[model samples]
Target chain A: MNLYELTIGEAHGLLSRKEISAVELTRAVLARITEKDEKIGAYITVTEASALKQAALADERIAGGDMTPLTGIPLAIKDLICTKDIKTTCASAILENFIPPYDAAVMEKLNRAGAVLLGKANMDEFAMGSSTENSGFKITRNPWDPGRVPGGSSGGSAAAVAADLCLGSLGSDTGGSIRQPASHCGVVGMKPTYGRVSRFGLVAFASSLDQIGPLTKTVSDCALMMNAISGYDNRDSTSVPREVPDYTQSLTQGLKEVTIGIPRQYFETDGLDPSVFLAVQKAVKTLQDRGATLVDVSLPHTSYAVAVYYIVAPAEASSNLARYDGVKYGARDKTQSSLLGMYRQTRSKGFGKEVQRRIILGTYALSSGYYEAYYNKASQVRTLIMEDFNTAFKTCDVLLSPVTPSPAFKFGEKREDPLALYLSDIYTISANLAGIPGMSVPCGFSQEGLPVGLQILGPHFNETMLLKVAYNFEQATDFHKAKPVF
Target chain B: MKITREEVIHVARLARLELDETDIETFSHQIGTILEYFDTLNQVDTQGVKPTSHAIFLTNAFREDEIKPHLDREKAMANAPEKENGYFLVPRVIG
Candidate 1:
């Protein structure tokens, strides 16, 4: 097998046995990027020079017998995560030249674990869009079908993994960003419960909803990545003070006695592609036949999730994004002589259309007269949505649904219609709204050959249940074994 | 819920964004449609429910008041669009 195609677990075994060095693995990945990235457009920055240097250091660590599971593993980072010396452009022109001086807490942990940095992956500008076509630089194409989007704002991370540019990647999920892309790319994506992973380095979109997780070639690799990143940090105030188990230890063969709930509302979602629905139904039956019990559950407030998310996310985004006033950081409009003019010009020129739209929506929602009518009302509905999930978890250990309503759609298919694009996230958005853990594992492919994702959702901080069920599902299916021929 | 061109311009001003006439017209239509869709939130009865700002309830997370090394001025101003010897340069706020 190609070194570039090895999962984290596979590569770690080889590295620890001295069968291959980190430099060889790093070079193999860099070569793959140099060979194929022009067609994929999965990276904003490749970090070739620094990646080799880090890989050399990882080899030294392995020689000294001080290695972690991620030691010497080359991985791509979603551009939103801050890296000390690398240019972390959140795929926005505003921060095109912005270089962060400090490393995010997650980056610090990865560095300590001796992981090699491949580069910064592309994302939606400021992570406000569902398709990476919103990226200011370039659109990330699905490796499965180059004409379709890989999904965003973590589209690049998923594409890189699917195309074997990197072994595994780190992606942040605000509203189904990671899982959607991983689904589109035929990879495993896990979004841990809010606060389970530190948010210190992740650039904020909606502070209350954002969580950083992993996109990998397999569920076990996802667990290994989680073990390294899931812990408390003083930097993030919301970082939970809980014991992070060795996530890999939860990987077992069977799902005996596991109750997988099928959310009736999710199955009855409007505009759901018939193929996706059929695929998820088959996935549920497969789990049931493999010793799991299926239960019918209902999250009655599912209809209100999209409405609540749009308002609440934008409101928090407006406040979180206010920091980019062309003064403290980011580019400035030199032609404007007045302060307010500079602020206005810099922002208008810096942010993209979707970003501008959300900022305006957020500003209008938080405006003096409309706060109670829009933002406050949305917040109240958000509480009800959380209650619905809490109630459903009582009857089932995890809920099963389709990650996206359809397989990967072709470029420009839904880009023009904003409402149509928002509805694509109908099944996955509720997990984010409720601050629970959710994941996507490849189940089947469409008639057109695009991958379908089966979503597994667990209650807050119950990633173990989600991972166990996903691991069992992955072991039973060969869907994840199928790679996109690049 | 109807976002007019004037309202779009007004909200842009509040958000400190400069917009052209075409952008104003387009945003007026787009924002109006999205908010029209958002009208579904009004259907839910939230009379007695408390607004949740965060998914998980958290209080003031305090830490010991201790001295920690701060970022050096050079690194802090590394990405500033305009920078002086050791500070970020901004438009004059004082007359």
Candidate 2:
């Protein structure tokens, strides 16, 4: 197989068997990035020297007979993650030149696993929008259609995987940042339960809801990467302590008696595209044929999820992002001679329009006059949203829905209307609010040729169930076999 | 849905953003259009229903109150737009 198209498992087997060298594999992917990134805009920073150095070390480890799950594999990390001594820009102007002195927990884990770092992928400025157009550095185009954007925040990582620049990538999801992009790029993206992965050293956008996850071309590959990265870290107080199981071992489990819940309200909404509905409906048929019993379930608080999310996320972001006050590790406008001028100039010039809007709205909601009516109330409503999911899970093993309302749209399609862009995450936001695990896998395609995704959501810490059901559905359909055209 | 000039100015100030006349004119209309759509929140029956904020069950996680090592003041102030001695300097407080 061509180096660019190699799977993580394939690369490991070849490396251990001495059929391929780590330097060659890393060089091959670097060459692919140099050739294709101009058109796709997948990476903001390509670490050629560091990647080669890591590859050499990986080769040394193999020569010494020491191998790990990520040994000798090239992986792309979303820019939202911090890497010590490496420039981490979150695709925003504010931290344009910032170089972190500490490594994010996953970066440290991946390094210990001996993974070769390929590059830092682009993302929306602070992961604010659904479309990659919000990435101030560059826009990531879908490999399927250059005119359309790959979904945002993790868009660059998704595009990179779709274009075969890397075998796997780590992306942070606030509201479908990982899943939405994976759907657009025709890959498998998994968002583990809220605390499944550590957030230490992550460039915080929304503290309570943000999570790190894996995006890969297949379910097994995602599980493989997850095994290496998911675990408790002392640096991040929220990292869960549940035992990390062998997810790959569970992939072959058939769905003979598995009960899958179909949330009827998800696809019946007015905004859903007709083609997406047909695609998900077709996907459901395959699961039902696999001997999995289908049951209808209701998450009555679905409508309130987005409302609660907006208030809660912005409130968290407003506080989390306050750390970049130009007095610390980011850009500073030297011309501002006064204290207040420094604050205004640094922020006004550093942050983007959407970020400013959120900070403003969030600050207002948290203000004394509005606290009880907004922030406090949103917290109470958030409980109802979680309870809604908890109640649904008692009746079925997992819940399934469409990953997005529609396929990728044109560059300017929803840029003018921010609300329309936020609505794009309607189906996925509740998962974040409830802190459950959700995965998006290719289900079918729209007639216009864009890939459609089916989302399988499971209760907190029940990622194994989500992946197993997705793996079974994948085995039954050729949807994932569809490749993007360059 | 109609946002007044005063509200626009107030939000901009709260956001710590500097807005030109064009920005004010555009935002007043744009934000109004978006906020009107938020009427969807009101449409959902929330009466007597407790509002939710956090999703996870964990709460009030506390750490020891002992002072922790923070970034050095010199290093932290090095990136400031303007700094005077050990302090981050900005505009005069007098508004």
Candidate 3:
């Protein structure tokens, strides 16, 4: 196999045995990025100089026999995460020139693990949209089909992993940013329980909904990344105080006696493409044939998830995004004369149209007269959505569903219709609403040959069970092994 | 509920964003359509259900009143669009 095609686990084995040097691996991946990323547009920045330096240090550590699983592994970071001295644009022109002075808690962990940073991946501007078309820089194409999108917000991260531009990548999920794209790109993408991972320095979109997680070629690599990135951090007030498990150790080869719930509402939802339904159904049957029991479950509130998410996410976003006024950091508008004018012009020129729309929607929702009617009502209904999941989990260990209603769609398909784009996330938004760990694994392909994702969801902080279920499913199929021929 | 063009402009003002007339009209129609879908929430009788700001309940996380080293002055000012004398430059507020 080519060096660029090795998974994190395989590379670790080779690195430990001195069969390949860190610099060699890093160069191979960088060469792949140079060759393919121009057509794919998967990255905003590629740090060739800094990456080689880091690889040299990682090689020194491996030579000293002080290596970790991620040592010398080239990984891409979704541009939202803060990396010290590196430009962390959340795919917005507002922060296009902004470089953070500190590393995010997750970046600190990755740095300590001796991982090599490939560069910043492209994303939806401030993670506001479901597709990377919202990116301020360039649109990322699906490696499988150049005419299609690679999913959103974390589209670049998913596309990078899918195209073998990097071994693994980190992405933040608010709504279905990570999983939806991971599904579209045919890789393993996970979003941990809301507070299971720290959010400090994560360039907040919706403070209550965002969580950083991993996108990798296999479930085991996803688990290895989970072990590295998940833990408690006092820097973030919402990070849960819980025991961090060795997620890779939880990858058992059995699904015996496990009860998997099939949320009936997801299957019956309007606009669910027939091909996606069949693929997900086939995946569930594969699980049942392997000794797991499938139970029909109801999450009646599922229908309201998209509505509640639109209100709640935008409400938080308006407040969180109010910080960018061309004052402290980011690009400033020089033509404005007055203070308020600067704020208006800087934001108007910097933020994209979808971003502007959300800011307005959020502002209206939280405005004086509309607060109780829109924002408050949405939050109250959010509780009902959570309770639905809690009640369903009472009878099943995990819930199985489709990641998105359809396989990857062609670009400009839903670009003009905002509501159509929002409706596509119906299946995956409930997990974020309930603050549960959710993941998307490649299960089957549609008639168009685009990948389909099987979504597995577990209650809060129940990542071990979700990973085990995904790991077992991955072992049963060669779907994860199928790579996009670049 | 239908979002009017005037309301869209008003909300844009509150968000400190300057939208052209074309954008205001487009947003008014789009936001109105989305808010119409959100009206589905009003049907669910959440009479006494408490509003949840977060999925999991967390309280004020306090630590010992401690001080740690913070970002150096140079690094903090590095990304400022306009900076002078180790401080960010903003529009004049008073005559």
Greater DockQ among 1 and 3 belongs to 3
Best candidate, lDDT-wise? 3
Candidate 3, residue A477: the lDDT equals: 95
List candidate 1 stretches off by more than 4 Å: none
Q: Give the Cα-based TM-score of candidate 1 against the true structure.
A: 0.99
Superposing all C-alpha atoms, what RMSD in Å does each candidate have to the true structure? Answer: 0.9, 2.3, 0.9
Q: Write the per-residue lDDT of candidate 3 for residues A142-186, one digit (tens) a residue.
A: 999999999988999999999999999999999999999999999
TM-score of 3: 0.99
Candidates 1 and 2 compared: the better one by DockQ is 1
Per-residue lDDT of candidate 2, residues A1-486 (tens digit): 689788788888999998998999999999999998899999999999999999999999999999986898999999989987788999989889888766898999999999999989999899988877888788988999999999977999999998998989999899889999999888999998998899998889888899999999889899999899899776687776678998899889889868989998897776899989998898888999988899999988787667677778878888887777677568876676676667677787888878877776677668767687667777777777888888999999999999999998989999777777877788999999889999999988888899888999998988889889998988998887788878
TM-score of each: 0.99, 0.95, 0.99
- The total of clashing pairs for model 2 equals 18
CA error at residue B75 for candidate 3, angstroms? 1.7
User: Which pairs of residues have clashing backbones in candidate 3?
Assistant: none
In candidate 2, position A470 carries an lDDT of 91
